[model samples]
Target: MSKKIISVIVALIFILNSIPVFAWTPAESLTSSSVVLMDTVRGQVLFEKNAYKHLSPSVMCKLMTALVTIEKTDLNAKVTISKNAASFNGLNLVVGNQYTVEDLLYAVMLSQGNDAAVALAEYVGDGDIKKFVRYMNTEAKELSLKDTYFVNPTGLYEKAQYTSANDIALLIKAAISNNTFNVIFGARGFGWLNGNNSSILTNQNTLFWSYKGVDGGKLGTNTNPQSFSAVTTASQNDKRLIAVVFNTSKESAFSETAKLFDYGFSKFYTGVLVPKNISQRSIEVDNVKLDLSSKIDVYYTYPVGDSFIKNISFIPNEKLKLPVNTETIAGVLKYTLNDNTVIEVNLYSDKTVSAPEDYRTKIKEIVTENRDLVTIVGILGIIEIILIIKNLIKFMLRAKKTRTQQ
Candidate 1:
């Protein structure tokens, strides 16, 4: 081939190679069997795919185990490892070895140590493994997770132990809220020495290396069921999100979670549903005026270009009685999207209203104090005068009739 022709061919190849071989679509691109992306600040789901499907959570259950341990036992407390705990696969925790709860927590969170999980559970459960699992179930119930159950502290492949992607996201949200859990979950690596034995823990969450704004995460895998799962959290541009993926390959877990976080941060954001220092207004009850309290600093997450701010309606409680006390709930501020209620916040009275009475002196004083009260007082005064004149005329007519009968 001629030199010019060869150059042209090479250029064509370069252009074709630069073109995308596949289009990216979140719903179709993900490889996980189940996935969920949530706005942690607003507790709203940004994306989901079979999110409720039951699957073996594998080691992701350690998050709950860590949470229970953090709550039940002090971090500085010393825990003696038992034979059962030491027998846990993966970590080489020696039987009768002693380690601080805090050190073991790092292992459980960052290193994915099954032995550490059992040790923490034993300490928190008072040496009863079954009781520790019960505590995990109790927490799941308290979180209102309908599809989660725990048969062990370590997320081993138990036939009866299973959780959904949605439930795992919820669990992570609850776990990361704690300062201790958050710190350990985000650590890239932690190291310590226990009686001449050097122990080091390192995070397996690849998103920390591959993505930005990754705060914390957990990974789980099981060969018996051939399952892989991951839960991750990230914050960007004032928005925080949690993502979970299950039944995926180890590599796909990180990539899929990154895609979910990208979708969430790019497509959703927190918006003010009600602005702070909203103008205070008044409601009239039984001819008495009660001032409504202002709503301040309320927000919710929504699609990037869509907003519920304009759709919010402040509806005062119609049944509020006169003489409403200050700070009493008098109404609700309803936030609606597509005509469906999304949030309802209670409205309270800013100031109390006294009982309504036709005291002329009080009315005169109110009218003098507020120009707006004049019209109301004037109409009431006219009505009172008309009723008084009608009574007087009836009395005169009755007296005249009595005189005529005499």
Candidate 2:
């Protein structure tokens, strides 16, 4: 090759290599049987594995029971124990225990009592488990848990009761968003006040102590699935991540959950993947190169040490027209979190660009606005000019007549 050609090619290669590159770290294997990690605010799914397969979620179902009961009854409202509820296979709240909704909620959640969960359901539905079951399904649908189906609140091994890790994560998101629900689930311990003041059942979520900045959560187990599910909210340096893991070993779920939380907080960060100052490449509009004017920004609070890749994809909307309206979406910003879950942002015109106007059109607009005043002024000026011309002609004739008389 000629020396000139070789030099030009070398320069181009150097320029291309100088451009910056960024990416989020890929995930490592976690100990849980199934996991679903996500950013709650941005709706960004950071990690997952076998999240949709239906499996048993043991006492973890109490979250739903507690939530549904709270939805139908006030905390202080009294609910009498039903014969059917008291017979469920677990720690039975004695048949004669007259308790308020609040007391049962504490006992059911802290002790993982089957009877307490059933009693609340029966009290809410007037001794009808079938109607209460319907309520559970309806609530699940409302929360968009299409993969979850419920036949009972206690999450006992029933023929039809089942949920997946994904559905459980969705349920946790819904529960934590509610102010009252978040407060109740995270509560460490509350008094039963049923005569024995010394009787206390603490929460089962151990991460609250072993894990730092750990928020409210729950744990569940059963023979068929050996399922364990937990919702944890942890923050580092003011950044936060909401993590969910389901169907893990009873001994390892806490450690697995903690490791997942650690990975999230330690590897990634929350900021605009596409920095605010950077401009998108230009696009052709009506044979003219119009500067692409749309911008994208992503924000979520996360742990400092999590791995993340800043992927920005450009998409075109064929339906969009040239000189785009500021309000119209011309494209989308597809953000792929390192975990492979994706989200999209609509790209719109950065500024208003309307159809152009001509000089004549602008003048016409001005004339129309001042039409009455302009017309009257113009008529008066014409009359004044005509009168001056007539007076000048008369003076000229008078001067000629005076010269002839002299």
Candidate 3:
């Protein structure tokens, strides 16, 4: 081929390669009554379909129960199953048999144990499961979840107890935020803690089958009222995401949650906006150059082939002062998308300097601190000056008398 023709072809290929192979688009084929895909790392809703519609998301509410349990009690402590708990339909809990709180947590999340959740509630509530339900409602209120209400820890179908997809996502994020709770949620299978009832139990969450980086998930199904739901957490390349689906079929719950994860993961790629401890820009304070940089890495998620603009501003415009230590705030760094601030970090100075004005101020402060000593020194200096003046007068008179005698 001619060199000119080859060059033209190469240029065309390069231009085409720079474009996205597949453009970003909203997720489709989702039939769940309520759905939400949240970027848990940033806590932003990446995708949603009727996310706020209130419905019975069912057993996924065990996530909230597990959250309360981890916060209020010890995980190593053993909880004896009660008849009320043992009467529940799942996990086959034996009345008066003791199980570690940690094991029961696994049951709550993995084994789909209504009995295990109730047992945990009774122990944590001082033998009153209703009190634990109250605790869950209180926590939901504190978390600013307006659509969540709890009537039981087991997540059994109740007309009075209901939650939205958004609330369930929030619950999953909160539940996994704790290390212990996260471990329990991530468990694919766990053996019984009791020696007599020892048997390996597998997690009912189906996301583990086809999803990559699925850390943990929960599936809730109530056939009596025909409600099915799923909450899933997964991570990819240091970014974590949560997906919640409600009012879907039992099989579709898993598939729909997986689809949400796929959409959420494929929609964005992690990019380091600015490196840590490297100067993005600089400002001068009292003639000392202040290189502005974040103490930690500044990262943001964006669609593939997308670009961003950074607009950083120093707040109060006066924090930039002399005698700046390493800990001094240089300014606030803001990363924006479409004019909305996605994240704001406090920029710090890599240089320290003391201005002449600062030194004078410092001296004044020292003098104020030791005013008595300063006063004594001032009086002694004035007395010494007066003595020198008197000696000079005597010497001048002696010199004049000698000249007259001569």
Candidate 4:
């Protein structure tokens, strides 16, 4: 072969080799075994990989612990640390120390204090650790988490104490709904002072350092399974994203979470599936027409350049009864994507349609409707009566005249 032909062949081989062999998939660049990205506002999953795989959440369980504590007890209440709680090796809490619930919560979130977890659990559970664990499981069930079960409040590596990446993301969403929890979670660091000593507690979640728009998150690491997990929330352009990564190295957890955030923000955006003022049309029921109420805007987070509005269908309720009251629900607008119902909203009537009037009222209505025709008929009847009377008077006068002539 000529030199030019060989050069062309070599160049083609290099280009082919550079192309990826497998089709592109989400979280492909991450080392985590399970990952999920969720749009909190729309409650939609933007990306996932084995998101339901059950694994030990380790210290990440503190999220639930903090949530249960904050919800069930007053933050200003003081908690006396117990010996069992202080025995946890990594925590700096002292036995018999008294700290406010708010202080312990900050310690648990910012410092990842297992001791604080125990103290809060004990205080919230009224000194029963088992009861607190049961509360955790109950809350998990209430959230409809199928792949989660908490064996302890501290998430101290019980084989049965496991949760999925998706469940953690869901729990985070619920946790953030509370203003108190949300504020605590977002804190970067806090000052600490007790009777004996004072120290600073810093947030361990590395996303605050590496990623922009990092609002809050939790981190976990366990040696039993050699797993690391992280859940983080970030916001940009008036949109917020929650990302969870499980069963990865400590360093990879934050990195993978950032990767998920990047994917979500770059590929997806909030769009209106159903616009406000969706319909100006009227619906007829029982010969009575009624106008529709103003429509509500339904939003969804979807892939860029994809249109979901076209797939929306407005279907009036077939079983609508007569005499529909104003602002009553008369139908539903359903939005379906890929043969699945994504969003649905009730449609209401703007005006009432009263039932038909009674027979007497109906007769009066008919007369009023044909007033011109009734007036013409009345005039013709009066003229006929006058003619009859005139004929009768003429007959009587002729009869009298004939008798007199005879």
Q: Give the TM-scores of the predictions, in the order they appear.
A: 0.77, 0.66, 0.77, 0.78
**Deviation in angstroms for 188 in model 3?**
0.7
lDDT of 1 by residue, 1-406 (tens): 8999999999999999999876345797787888999877656777889989888867657888888888888999999989999888756788887999998888888866899899988898898989999999999999888899999987888898888888888877777788888888788788966567776667888888889999888788765678778888898988789988875488888888888887878777787766644544567888776666545677778776777344767788877887788667788777666424377767677666766667896867777788767878778999999999999999999999999999
Of the two candidates 1 and 2, the one with more favorable TM-score, higher being better, is: 1
lDDT of 3: 0.79
State residue 127's C-alpha deviation in candidate 2, in Å: 4.0
Q: Each candidate: RMSD to true structure?
A: 10.7, 12.6, 7.4, 10.0
- List where candidate 4 sits over 4 angstroms from the true fold: 1-27, 280-282, 291-295, 308-315, 338-341, 359-406
- Rank candidates, lDDT, best first: 4, 1, 3, 2
Each model's lDDT: 0.80, 0.71, 0.79, 0.81
Please list all clashing residue pairs in model 4, or write none if there are none: none
Question: What global local distance difference test value does model 1 have?
Answer: 0.80
Task: Give the deviation of candidate 4 from the true structure as CA RMSD.
Answer: 10.0
**Candidate number with the higher TM-score (2 or 3):** 3
lDDT of 4 at 277: 57
- Over 322-390, each residue of candidate 4 has an lDDT whose tens digit, in order, gives 768856778776766641437777777876667778999798888899999888988999999999999
For candidate 1, list the clashing residue pairs, or say none.
Answer: none
Return the number of clashes found in candidate 3.
Answer: 0
Provide the clashing-pair count of each candidate structure: 0, 12, 0, 0
Error of 3 at 137 (Å): 2.9
- Model 3, 302-373: lDDT tens digits are 656676454554452475677788788778766666325377778888877876656788899889999999
Off by over 4 Å in 2: 1-32, 42-50, 70-78, 89-103, 142-146, 195-199, 225-231, 242-249, 274-297, 300-311, 315-331, 352-406
